[model samples]
Structure formats: C-alpha cells, structure tokens
Target: MAFFLWLPALLLAALSEPAAASAGTSICNDTGALHQLAVTARTDGSWITQGWQALAPGDCTNPLPEGYQGRFFYFRAESPGYQFRDDSIRFCTKAGPFRAGGSGDCAARGYREQAFARARISTDSQKIPLSSRSQAAAAAPDTDAAGGTPYTAAVVLQGCSPEQEGAPAACRFVGGGMEIRATAGKQAAVPAFAFLMTLQQGAPLAVEGELISSFGSHGDLDLHSAALRQPNRHDRLLRQMQGRWVSAADPGDSFTLSGAVRQVSYRGSAMPPEFVSVLDTCHGAGTAGDFLLARDSERGTGLCYRIQSLGSDELTLIYLPRGTRLVYRRLPEG
Candidate 1:
C-alpha cells in the first residue's frame, strides 16, 4: 500500500540585509506569470496577517504602507496552476481583504491558517523581490574561473535512445526548474532506464561520460547530483532509505520514501501522512537534528517534524504533536 501527500506550490522568499532605509517593502514579480501573494508581519506587538494580493508578470506591488521593523516578515505566493511557495511559517488568512489579529489558534479564533515564507526585516532594508527562476541555480556548478560555461545537473534515461547520437540537447530555465533537452527515438530499445547528465549553462551541451546510472522500469525519477563534494550524513541516511520500505511487524504496511535536493516524498497506506512534501531549509543542523516543514495543499496549516534517529537500514521519525515514533526497515530492491 502506497500513500501520497500532494504539495502543490511551495515557494520561499529570499532575504537580504541591505544598507538602505526605505518607507515600506516593495515586492517585485520577475517570473513571466501572474502570482497571488499574501503576507504576515509583526506590528504593534501583535502578529498581523493579510493576503490574496495579485501581481502580473514583471510587475511590482505598490510600496505597501507598512514600514520595516526589526522583525521577521512572512510571505506566500502562488500562480494559477502551480504550487504555493512558503517558508513553513503558519499564520492566519481569509479569502477577501481582511486582517487577522493574532497568530495563535487561528481555527479556534475563526481564521484559517496558511504557511508563509519568512523574511527577516532589518531596519535598513525594505524590499522583497519574488521571482519564478530556478532556486537550484544558486547551487548549480559555477563556470571555470577562466570564464567557461557552468554546468547544471541533468538526467537521461537508458531506454530513451537518442534520435541522433550527438544531437544538441535543449536546455532552459523553466517554471518547474532547470530542464535539459534530449531527442529520444519513438521506440525504446531497452527497458525503461535513465542516465543523469551534466549540462553546460547557456548551451544544451552535456559533458561526455557524465551518465549517472540506468533504472529499469522505475516510474518518474528525479536525479540530483552536485559536483564531487563531501556527502551529508542525513542525506546519506535518506538515500539509504529510498526504495520500498516495510514495517518490521507488518508486511502489508509499507511505503516508499524518496528524496531530492531540498525535498522528500513518502507514499504508503497511511491517510496522506500528516506531513507531505517535506522541505528542508533549516541549515547547519546535522543528520538527526534537522527540521522538516510540511506543505499540504488541502490544508495550508504549517507543521514541523524533527528527525529522531537514523541507523543503517532503519529510520526513526517522531511526529511533533504526540511524539509518535515511526520506524521503518528498508525493503530489498527487486
């Protein structure tokens, strides 16, 4: 039994402390699409939440009347057909132009809770620019110091035979993320397989001998390979649990856990596991000390889960509310 929690658009705003004093915050939308935005900030010793502000492509919001205070501001934005980007902070929100008084017990207080992206507002800076560009670009391999084209991560499946062996691959930065282009013949000569390719920026050129591996008959595959660097302990533990996992006591109770750059997915028999689409942004925390924030589409409520322990072939996760421990064993790969 495989269960899945769907997380649509989970966006987060980048924060920077510039040496300038401005009246209010100016939000700019750099993506070529419309975005519905929301925000939460602390003012007058209380947290205020407001929302549904819409922005057209290449447009900036009117300098909101609120001035910058030395505190963290939260924001959320989403396109018509995409997922909402949030910072894993929970705040109250309503449908129309309305304000919520406090951030506590939103539901009990007759307000709806929604996740927000957090931005620390220093007294000096007053601008928040939002874009739809690939966040992965920051982590992308930089060009050689001599000014050569940089490399980006990519994957090509084994079964996807190229129409022309050395034909140029299409590379572009799109909404979902960076995409690598390749021409595959209509027919697959082998079982469904994939190869991770390293792409050069600006051109669709792939580095030779950059193939990662071939997965036979696997469904959708997300390949993430950064330049050769020290492996993260938590990441290594997560990778060890990627395949099908079953409960030690019950075979019928099982799930599949997969991970990517800053995200993780779990599918199993549970009722849409409380946490779906866990985004890892809290840095500096070690393997078993990191925090995972959940972004659920149906319920915009923000939830946080902490990793308790991870061992060889087994993992332990504690649900924050009740401290429920879920231990799973890795199932043998078929």
Candidate 2:
C-alpha cells in the first residue's frame, strides 16, 4: 500500500538488429485460454519478468534493446535494506492490455514500476510460464501482503461428535502448511498463524475475532475461520415467521410453541352481549419472548426451554406442558 516516485530517467529506445522473430506461430498468439507461465528472476540479467497472453500483438512499435528479453514486470519501493518472502510473481496473459478481462488482475492496477521483456513457459499441469531474473536481490520487505494466493492448507474438524462431551466444535490445521514471513529492522521471523480451510473456496465466514494475533512461523497475521454449525429445525421455523407470530386460536388450552415468536396474546369472548377480552403477558410488545423451545434433558418427546432474557447470559429454556404455570424469579446480585 505504499508508492515511490522517481523522475523519468529512461525512454523507449529503438533496436537496430532485432533478434530472429520467432517463426512457426509464437506461443503468445494461441487462441485457447491464455496459458499461465512461470518466470524466475535469473542470476543472469537475461529475463527478469513473466506474464501471459492468448495472442500477443506483434512487438510494440519500439521494443527494448535488441537482446532486452524481459517479460514479467514487477516493482517494489522496499528493496536493498528491506526483504520479502511469500511473494507472488505470476500473472495471467489476456487479450487486452494487462489481462484486464480475467476474474483476477494479478497485480491490481497502479503498482507497476518495471515491466517484463520476456517470459519462459512452466511445466505444471496448468502449463504455466515464468520469466527469469539477473541476480536475486537480498530479500526485501514484503510489499504484497494483501495479494491473494491459490495456495491452500489442510484443516481438520474436531470435537463435534457425541464422544467429545461438552467441548465446542473446532476446526484446526492437521498438516504442515506454508507460513507467512515478515521483517521489521534486522529481526526477521515467522509467526504462528493458521489459515481456515474455508477461505480456500472464497466463502465469507468470520473476519474479526478469528485471526490469532502473531500466531505462526512468520509474524502473526489475521486468519479466516470456518462455519461450525448449521441452523436447526426450530431456527428455520423462527426465520419463516420473520420474527413475528401469534398463538393458535385455542392454544390447546395450554400449548407450548415449537419455536420462538415475537408476540403472544389471548383473545377471548364471553358475556350477555359477547364482550371480548385481550390478555397481554410476558415479553415486549414487538420483541421476541425471553426463551426458545429446546430439547429436554431427558431427550424425550417433550420440550424444554432456553431463555435469552439478559444480555451475555447463557440461554436456559424451561418447558411447561399443558396445565402448567411456572414462576419467574430473579436473584439479587452477589
């Protein structure tokens, strides 16, 4: 997220004798999806960049020196004294300028200072390509901390089955994975941080309170977490009501709700002229009642309740079958 500005010191130059123009169809002009290429900064100054292209338009009106073979373009303000690791150097070739049409623009706009002159092909399943560099610069401070990578780590779900006994379900890394590396001053080290397997597919889960600060082989960074539980039948029913509902006409003379409702009222009619009576009880006028119907401790056909009466209090639902009235009590602060 930083930038460096330098006065223009170089201009495009024309080449006298161009290297033999590749014949028999250049790989850059393929019609299929532009294949990815691997480009490493070679110890020699031959190729210092790597990128992709489905159909490379013939050389620019003015190309670099006759042997100026650089293809993958990269730039960073932090070099020399600073260092970098876990940096991504791959980019997709596109039909238009800078592969703008693809889902991901490898180097989000405005970050280019130097451009590649040539690129080499990759040998992976994707048939990627890469460009080489002259000499490996001393590791520089990581300048691309926000870049998303295709790398993923292994994670295992644990403590959810009946045998775990009271332990909250948790997802944890079960195998070795890449570590984020960072440095400030002369101190360079890895932290203890784990990546949520869920993030690999790009599903949005927890953002805050999920990242373990400074946790991992490299400097600790916030990590993503996984979804632990799904909504149950009662939760689904409550959602259907849109947070509002009324008891049945008879209410079974003493019925209990299968799910939480926003309001509960009794309407009765009686008398010489048939007068109507309205009974308003527990819970706010437009707010959900204090408790949610839950499975009983006995785990039988009956129901129990879990109350959410006070903020930050564990819900404890109490089930009162037909013809039962339970008293509400509050204990004094100790």
Candidate 1, 240-324: lDDT as tens digits:
5456666554555566543321232323334332222222432233344555444322222334456666666776665544454
Candidate 2 lDDT (Cα, 0 to 1):
0.24
Model 2 off-target regions past 4 Å? 1-117, 120-134, 146-221, 224-226, 229-334
TM-score of every candidate: 0.35, 0.20
| lDDT (tens digit, per residue) of candidate 2 on 98-145 | 212222344363223222233332222121111112222455333323
Best model number under lDDT: 1
Candidate 1 segments whose C-alpha is farther than 4 A from its true place: 1-37, 43-77, 81-226, 248-252, 259-288, 292-303
lDDT of 2 at 51: 26
